[model samples]
Target: MASRRTISSEKGFIEKGDATAFSPAALEKSNIAPAVPPGVIFKLLAFTFAMVVFPIGSYFATVNTIFRGKMSNSTFAGATAAFIANVVLIGYVIVAMKEDQSERLEAEEEAKKSK
Candidate 1:
């Protein structure tokens, strides 16, 4: 069974241990937020290309001398592809981030004008 206790009126009915989160002052603060979800696919693809593919391809490309290395034509081609893919993904992410930022700024400005 759950225990129930009456809160004293002097303390604004806030329960113990809820002082920080349920406080009235905390409820008034807000911020302009990002439009995109945290797990958006463009962001995932960009991060994967930048963090995973780029480094592995770079390692294969530099493991030995360029002219006499064990790296074959296929390996070189794969490396080139990885680098290009990362570049494209990174560019798309940059554009997306900028657009989100602009939208957030505009929203904030409009909100301020209303008040």
Candidate 2:
């Protein structure tokens, strides 16, 4: 006697022992590309850097000079840092919106050209 292993298909049948059908080498041949734009990635990294560096830099820079290093003035330095963070966030938002708008306009132009 012999064992039989099979899988049904739309056209006919497939053997269950066909390991090559789902092999890593086969999967690696995919033609898919990254969905994100490189510019978007760069912008995200830039904003992240700004978010970290600007706030801390502002706090330290102002704590001694603008705020006189007093314990009470430390609060002002903190506030300034928070404000800089907010500004960076707003700038990121504005940049993303502008990029989206530009992409949308380009798509519309392409559609018009196609028609």
Best by lDDT: 2
Please provide, for model 2 over 21-108, each residue's C-alpha lDDT reduced to its tens digit, 9 standing for 90 to 100: 6789989997588799788999999999999999999999999899995779889999999999999999999999999999999999
Model 1 lDDT per residue over 34-68, tens place: 67666576776767666676666665565443524
Local error of candidate 1 at residue 113 (angstroms):
1.4
TM-score versus the correct structure, for each prediction: 0.38, 0.75
RMSD of 1: 10.0
Q: 7, model 1: CA deviation in Å? A: 54
What clash pairs does model 2 have?
none
What does each candidate score in C-alpha RMSD?
Answer: 10.0, 8.0
Q: Return the clash pairs for model 1, or none.
A: none
